[model samples]
Target: MTTYKRMVLASRPKGVVSPQNFRLEEVQAPALKDGEVLIRNHYLSLDPYMRMRMEDVKSYAAPQAIGETMIGGTVGEVVESKNPKYAVGDKVQGMLGWSEMGVSDGVMLRKLDTTHVPLSAYLGSVGMPGMTAWYGLTQIMQPKEGETIVVSAASGAVGSVVGQLAKLRGCRAVGIAGGKEKCDYVVNELGFDACVDYKAGNLVDDLARATPNGIDAVFENVGGTIFDECVARMNPFGRIALCGLIAGYDGEPMALNNVRNILTMRLTMRGFIVSEHMDLWPQGLKELGTLVATGKLKFRESVAQGLESAPEAFIGMLKGKNFGKQLVKLV
Candidate 1:
């Protein structure tokens, strides 16, 4: 039997991820059965959620076991198929690991048409990331016209979409990012009303000046220091959509000091996962798709070359090194 190369978790990570924590291994892929297809991975999305999976802790999602293939979503091409629903040369989105190729049951794989958009779109704005923003805004945060919205990690895969959606709905959008360059991108290119540089050392004061009336809705991505400030500044009856906490997911818990704000403001906070709200995905996708197709939506991706660079790309993403969606191109 012929085998393919894959990146697997060698051991659980402690603080920050290093290349030594992961290993490349060759594993034999079994023959496809009925309702199964062989896929050639084209692109792999590296998200902040993956970092949480690297640790040994209880979370909403299950932790990836040591010595198993690292869990991630992928956009790939079907090279062979035993499933009647799928044919050769079809593009798909599936729960495939970081590998050259693999056979999977079509249950988790959704057929994709690259003709309408780029093949990588399934791993980006036209797919999960887009759906995440849609659900977080419409279902979770519930922003009203003239309300102010604040989002952390504002230049990232999920946060960027959150900011633009707020702007589209006639609300003032404020973004919090790591540096001046990223802050500029969200404000100038993505049309955010204001942005704060978290590294500039004035997150709390900047947020104060940017949102004078107080934040009505917050799309939270970095859930440590930024969250503490956001909770402190929330308006009465404010809505907060808690997404991934990249800063805290890396193992350093930020000290919090906002008990008075939560109690006095009476904020309603909710945490959501994109997959849990899959029932509304069709509607969300259709809406976001129209925006992308009409050019009202814009996306940026930092793509790594091949499977050999997956580890480095994964590491860089935890440190917020890439711009927009971080992807690994296998072919």
Candidate 2:
């Protein structure tokens, strides 16, 4: 094929993201140069972090350039190669953005062993999201056995892994998700000790009843009222790992009314970007991959068929529409 379809940021969102913000275009494929590999992307990862990158505001990483291919993680098979490091038919994962086909110079691509773990899983449980959970829970929270830990957005890709890992570490894992079905999946399927449904309009009361011992550690994903309520129940010397703030992703104000709890309870809170800590990927991915391969770590995916469905799917995810890890199936 001489041309391929790709999506680019057409316009930045003023508040909430809309379909108009993205423009799909067909572009001519360029010839591969030396040390470059060509890949036909099989899956595209739609993550909350991509929303943060859309704004031209100060952040840990530079904003996604307007008119550039939308930023995303992808897993695909190499179809053509000019690089000695990557052979054709080798499966690889890379930051290839939102495109059906991408060319990599072998620098950003990593080969995957899909013998046990599915190819798409490398984008979720055994990939970036998994590493994010591992770093936040193991490195930041550092919960002790018998301690109670609560994770917001508890049914999401990152939060689900956090709660499961906490359970494995002998901590009581309580989840906070949006709906009854999600809450049930968190508790029954993922095996969290309890899951509080935030959409039930009883976040404050429900969270209190779930954590009667008070929370020893918090894996915070949705920051806003959920985070504030969690903070209010934190035990003394609690540790918080701030991963994402999906509640306020659309320029909404995130005001925490329980700031005093952090001081009085002596809570330790740390915000992290998994990409910033490349040194830990080997160790984190190794453990995560093993657990997933052995069925000790379970995960789910909400797949949006075809690339054209990306914009709507992404908007839905921002509004808590996805069940688990949101992904786009591309071929």
Candidate 3:
């Protein structure tokens, strides 16, 4: 095909993201250069971090400019190649954005081994989310046996793995999710010790009951009230791995009322971007891939059918409408 479809940022979101913020358009696919590979993207990953990129405000990464293809992770099969490093029919992963097709010079793409893990998994459990969980739990939280470990957004792609890893390490895994279904999934499906539903309107009390021993380590995903409640229950010298703050991603500035807990409890909270620590990826992916390949690690996905569904699917994810990893199947 000479042309392909792509979703671009039509406008920066003011509060909550909506369909109007994205514009899907067809564009001419340029001919491959001497070192380029043409990939027909099969899946596109929708993540919370993409919300932060929608704003013009300063962040670790540049804001997605209006008219630029919406940034994302993708897994696809190379359909044509001019580069020796990659060949046609090689499945690969890259930051290819929300497009049906993308061209790469082999700098960003990495060939995948779909024999062990499914291709879609490269966008979820055995991919960035898994790496995030591993890095945060191992490099930062470092929970010891019998310690109470709490994770917010417990049913999400990252939080699910965090709690599972915590459980494997002999720590008591307590999850905090939005609803009863998600909480139940975290506890039963993912083997978390307990899961508290924040939307039940008894968050503080529910969390207290779940982490009766007091939180010793926390894998924080949703910030704002959920984070504040978790911090209020932290044990002295507890470690917190701050991954994402999806609760306040729309436009609201996050204000933690329990900031005093940090001082009183002497918490060690560290915020990290998974990509920054590339040194740990090989180790993290190896362990995660093994767990997944062996059936020790479990993950779920909520997929949208086509590329045109990306904007709506993304908005749903931001509102906690998706159960696990949200993905768009393009081909």
Candidate 4:
């Protein structure tokens, strides 16, 4: 029997997540029973939302159980299968957690066509992150052409896509990123109209300069003060797609001082979980896949090698240490 490495949640995080919260163990690969498929994961997605799952608290999804394999999105090749729907050597994507190999009964496993898009891209641009960007922008923050749209965490996986999609729709896309390098990339590389460097200690003035006409729509990822600043500059009847609030993910209090702007500006804010809207996945993924395939969309990745690197990589992602999409190369 072959052995595979897997990371399991060792404990619930009390504050900032530490390396001690995870335990890595080598386990034997199980035999594939009838209607089952065995996968060797190539890439593991480390996202911000995973931090919320590390705590034992009530939320949209259940907290990751201690002593279980850490929950994550994965893209890999099917090496063995008894299921008629899946063939050996098929590229597939699934919520297979942080493991070198996984067994699946095909409940939510999706076959991938990697001829145009790389297999790893399935975990980033054309996968859940891409769907998140699509749903939040098209479904919630429905901005029209010639409008100004601001995206917080603009250099991240979802935010990068949001800005790109906004531009494609003829909207003026402005990005809010942490540092100079990321801000430059958001503007020069991703084609965003302008990028505000929040770490430059002039967030309010910088954002104001970037959006001279005031923000007409917002794709908010970071909450707290960043959100308040955006709210303060929102145009009347502007829409906001409330995604992840990563600023408060470490149990920090998320106090918004601009709550009055929602009423004063008559802004429409909708908090959304992309997974809850499965009916729209086909439409969203189709458009994203086509855009990526034709080179109309662009993305970047920051990959950490090996399964053992998952814990540190995940921690780094939460701190905004990694650029673009953060992934663990399990192969």
Candidate 5:
């Protein structure tokens, strides 16, 4: 039997998660069942949504149970297969968690053609985060030419794509990110019209300057003060797609001071989970894949060394340390 390493949720976190919250263990891989396919994960995706799973709270999805393998998305190659649908040597992506190897019955896995795009791209730009940006911007926001669209966490996996898509549709894209370096990348590389550094201590003023005509739409990822500032500058009939609230993911309570803007500005705000909208995945993924393959869309990633480093990398990502998509190079 082949032995593989995996990380399991040891305990629910209180406030911020630490290394102690996770336990690394080595387990022997079992022989494949009649319909099972075994994969050797090459890369593991680390995303913000994983944080919410760590808490034992009522949510759109169930909390990660203690002693369960830490949930995650992964890209890997099939090493053994008992199913006729999936052949050995096939590359696939699935919710296989934070393990060096995983087994599945081929229900949730999607085969990947790595010739068109890199393997890791399936975890970021042409994958869930990219699809998220598409659903939020094109469906909810519906931004038009000459309109101003603001995106929070602008240099992140979803936010970067949001800004780029807005610009592609002829809207003026403004981004809000953490530091000067990320802000620079958002503006210069991603083609955002302007980027404001939230940590610069001039969030409100900088936002005001960026959206001189007021924001027509917002792709909100970070909540709390940043969200409040965006709401305060929203134009009448503006749309807000509430994708994530990373600011409060560590159990902090986020209070929005601009609640009245929803009524006063006649704004429309919608909170959605990308997974729930399976109907749109085909359309969104096709467009995202084409854009990425054609070089029209761009993205970056911060890769950690191995499975053992996932905890620290995940903790750092929550604290805004990652530049773009954060991934663990399991291979």
Candidate 6:
């Protein structure tokens, strides 16, 4: 019998997740069933969306059940396989629950070609984050060249790509982040036209100065007070692609006092989860690959040491401590 360490959700969180909400447990690995593969996790992505899963509520994905191994997206190497399509030593990304060692029925695991990029990137740039940014910007917002665009949490995994993509398309990108370093990186390194420091306590004023011409498109990531400013600044026929709401992922729903702004600005807002667009992920990955291969796309990750560090990573992400993609290296 093979036993592996697994992190299980201990209880539902109140507002913010603490260490008490998770428990490290030992579980025996089940025998390989038909069309299944055994794998050891290499990297796991810690996303803000996982915060929403901790609570029992209505969401795009079901809430993590009590006592389960939690949930996450991970990259792994196959060690044993009953599936003909996959071989031992193949690296893959699986929408597997949280565990050091796991078995997949081959349903959620996607075989990745490491010859193109690093295997860890499958959980970051070219994977969910990249696809989410691509779909939200190209398909949802549909901004034209020379337009002014703004995205909140612009230094994050999805928002960073969203701003860069807008810049590459000839739009002026204004980013809102937490500090001066991240703001400068977005403007100078990621190529955004300007960046505002939300921690500076001048978001609305800074946004006004940055986008004097008004915002034509917004790729919304954090939704709280920023959502108010976005609605006010959006021009007529402006587009908004709702991504994540890390600001309001707790037990309470987001508090918004300005519903009249939507009608006044004539904003076209659409909310979507990345999982719903898996059909387009192939095309998204191919295009993103070309962009990355040509040095047009850049990625940053705040890597944690091991699987046990996932909880700390998750906590940091929720507190807006991460500047870019946050990942836990399991192996």
Please, what are the lDDT tens digits per residue for candidate 2 over residues 118-207? 999999999999999999999999999999999988899999999999999999999999899999999999999999998899888999
Report the number of clashing residue pairs per model.
0, 0, 0, 0, 0, 0
List, residue by residue over 162-263, the lDDT tens digit for candidate 3. 999988999999988888899989988999999999989999898999989999999988899889989999999999999989888887889889889899
The TM-score values for the models, in the order shown, are 0.96, 0.99, 0.99, 0.99, 0.99, 0.97
Error of 4 at 238 (Å): 0.7
| Shift of residue 249 alpha carbon in model 2, Å | 1.0
> For residues 16-86, what per-residue lDDT tens digits would candidate 1 score against the true structure?
88899899988887888788899989998888888888887888878898888888889888988999989
Tens digits of per-residue lDDT for model 5, 1-331:
7999999999988899999999999999998899999999999999999999998889999999999999999999999999999999999999999999999999999999999899999999888999899999999999999999999999999999999999999999999999999999999999999999999999989999999999999999999999999999999999999999999998788988899999999999999999999899999999999999999999999999999999999999999999999999999
Stretches of candidate 5 above 4 Å error? none
- lDDT string for model 4 (138-183, tens) is 9988889999999999999999999999999999999999999999
In model 4, the Cα lDDT at residue 238 comes to 98
What C-alpha lDDT do the candidate models reach, one value each? 0.87, 0.94, 0.93, 0.94, 0.95, 0.87
Candidate 6, residue 204: lDDT: 84
By lDDT, the best candidate is 5
lDDT score at residue 133, model 5, on the 0-100 scale? 95
- lDDT, residue 54, candidate 4: 87
Q: What is residue 253's positional error in candidate 3, in angstroms?
A: 3.0
